[model samples]
Target: MFHNSGKLLFFLGKADRLRITVWLFSLTVITIAVPLAFGNLYPTQAERDVMAQTLSNPALTAMVGPVNFETYTIGTMTAHEMVLLTALVVGLMNILFVNRHTRVEEEEGLLELVRSLPTGKGANMMAVFLHILFINLLLVLLISVGLGVLGIESMGWNGSMLYGMVLGGSGIFFAGITAISAQLADNARTSFGIAFAVLMIAYLVRAVGDVSAETLSWFSPLHLSSQAEVYGANHWWTILPLFGVGILLFAVAGYMASLRDLDAGLLRSRAGKTTASSFLGTPTGLALRLQRTGIISWGIAMLLLGASYGSILGDLETFFEGNEILQQMLAGESSASFTEQFLSLLIVVIALIATIPALMSMLKLYKEEKSHRVDLLYAHPLSRFQFFASHLSIAAVQGLVMFLLAFAGLWMAGVAVMTEPFSFLTIVGAGMAYYPALLVMVGVTVLLIGFFPEKSGWVWAYLLYAFIVLYFGGLFEFPEWMEYLSPFGYVPELPNEDMTWLPLILLSMVALVMVTIGFRGYKRRDLQG
Candidate 1:
């Protein structure tokens, strides 16, 4: 078992995308650093009290966990902000890692090739688990050391260690969950969907539970380690439950892996209808069919987020009133009610999330091409334009669907929760307002795939850059041009500011031109695969 695990680990290491891993790790560090930096910027006791009061807002608490006003220090503030977000980052990493090595390898036929070698039945599974465990260890070390070094005086080593364990332990828990999911679902996408659903459920439960009752938070792995209450009345016992649950999940995953055959999942794929519909033969139909599940997954997540944000609208005014700092900032921007401002800001964030599915749809084209599936399809007399256009169309349509559905969810919540009159047209308009920016994201992905197929994954970095620029640019005091690099920058914050048609028109034109260039490049270039 040791020898087999070692061999498999070497293979996994070789196949891993080191660049992306490093980027993601750096992102985790940056995310942690931002709040610490913000906290440090406001060292006054008065400022800390104000920030702590703001953090206690139900709306804010719903996003992260509740703040401890009793221990209202910079470290506590940093921990309150960083805990959930860092858990999310590490959770995503573990999910992607397990899925890629387990299900994705099986789907791509590499798992079979590895199995043909002198390896034990569970060698591959154990190796992935070991690799992830090692990664989490490194994550713990980095986070602990980084926090200690950056916040030695405020948070202390004990608090830092506890916080690091909270993040790394949650990641380990999710790694085990994803491992089980990989064995249960035949395809990588399905495995990811299942794992993501579990992650979301756990997170939502933690969020709701943390806001309502202290005991309710115990059920979620995300909130389990956070029970340590770093920098306050620290309870070291919380770490025990987290690691214990993680080990149990890992053991269960191994047992499940032993039960399943390679490439055969517990949830077996169903056979398609014997007679194909005529439209199924067309590229557009095929693209839509392939993207249907992905669309639904993204849509559901958007709806959940939108509804959560909407339900909290009743607290927006109260939240603003409690935090004079936020009110001052909003006052400087617009005369609109706090509710409208909150909605406007949140919709932009929703738009950012909506861009993800659109980008994935476009990136799907790259994956298809690299997998040589496109070559096979081209052999069957399909034009390059038709093949390309089909996927791009799916992305565009998916983006529109995501935005509209998200707005619908928010509108429904507003009607349910708010006494004030809510305008459906206003919500629809806000959703539509995001279309051009989303198209620009899709266009950028297409442009990358066409011109730099080998390096197309860099589009993720661009998206991350856009996220930082759009959300933190003002806080960080970035140059106007840097903010402009994000398509969302040009978008008018609708419902607060009157809609501007010119920017939308120009953004649409930019997307069109980008698509044209990308298509032309894809057409003229030699097939990569």
Candidate 2:
């Protein structure tokens, strides 16, 4: 069943080396950087305790995970603050990584070519499993060794290994989930949807369980990973369930794969209507139909994300009232309230989240082109510009709607929780201030799709860079010039700093130029599959 698996593994590694490197490097850097900063940020045990206490509220527990600090050391703080979020990220990485290799390859007909050779029936999957295992192991080694090298007294080598193991276990667990999802869904999109839905459900369940009931958390892989309590009790036993369940799931996925035929799923796809609706006749309508499921999913996610952040807003004033470290990190000026300063930060985050769907919408054009779907459309009455406009327009409109839904969710939840709620219009205006920045991202995606469709993936890299620089710049005290690298940095931190129109206008102009150039490129370029 595993014949030639080594060759397939090497092939996959070669294809995905860059992505694997980025994930491992980013996760390790973040894991190590936090602890390194924590030692200096909260130098004394007293300060660490206060920081832990400030973060112990139900809202934060729901947002990150339950704080498991007994002595409130730097190690405990790092574990509490970083583990759950990082695990969630690692889980997502595994889901995408697995789905891309398994279901996506099958959908694109690559797996079929490999199978025509003398490879075993299960060779491809076995290779994927080995590839994922290798990546997770590398992640574990990098994070563990990186933290140990930091030489933080509280973050000892023993705890560092456990911390890295927790994340590695989480990644393997989610990789198994995606493996099963790949066997269950015929299409790459549906396969990814199923895997991501599971990821989101795990996070939501863990959040609810941590804030409400400890017993419920035991069911969530995310919660189970956090139970490792790396620097606290060093509950080494908690990691067993993650590895065990993951292996079980992998076995189940393998069995399912053996029983099914190539390019087919255990779960059947729904049959479409024999006759087309009038709405599907036009480019805009066709684009909407193709993207509606993703758009709806992103919209719901944005709303919930905004509400989650808003739920914690009521506690921010008290949380930041006396913590000099937090105050200095979040404070903008002497006059800005802590809540306002935090809102400014939150808006940057919300805007960035909103940008994803917008970017996805624009990138759909490239996906269609790569799949040769655009070729068929061009045979009809559709022009390249019309096809391009359809996706771009949807992206633009959906981006605005995302902001509105997110801000609306934020306002509704915030009003219920705060003693003195902020004005709805104020929050909306503050959020909308970042809309132009979102357009800048959309423009970049459009530019990539027009001129460099094969390299469309680079847009996501740029977005990730923008997120890190803009979101963590203040926390890391990144240089001021670094902020200007992303459009989000151009906008004033509204409601904390005075709103500036010049930056917004400039961002809009930049977006316009990119879109215009992308349109011209799309019109002139020969179609490639």
Best model per TM-score: 2
| Candidate 1 lDDT, 318-410, residue by residue in tens | 677655445543424678888887777778878888888889999999888776777778899899989998998888988888898888888
Mind sharing the TM-score for model 1? Answer: 0.92
Mark the regions of model 2 whose C-alpha exceeds 4 Å error after superposition.
none
Q: Model 2: per-residue lDDT, tens digit, 1-529?
A: 8899999999999999999988888888777778777777789998888887878889878977877667989888888888889999999999989999998888878899999999998888889989998999899999999988887788899999999899999999999999999999998888888899999999999999998898888778888766888877888887888888887888899899999999999999889999889989899999999888888888999999889888888867778876766675664554888998888888888999899889988888888888777788989987887888899899999999999999999998899899998999999999999999999888888788788888888888888888888776766778889879888888988789887899999999999999999889888888876
lDDT values of the candidates?
0.79, 0.87
Question: Which pairs of residues collide in candidate 2?
Answer: none
* Model 2 lowest lDDT segment of ten: 325-334
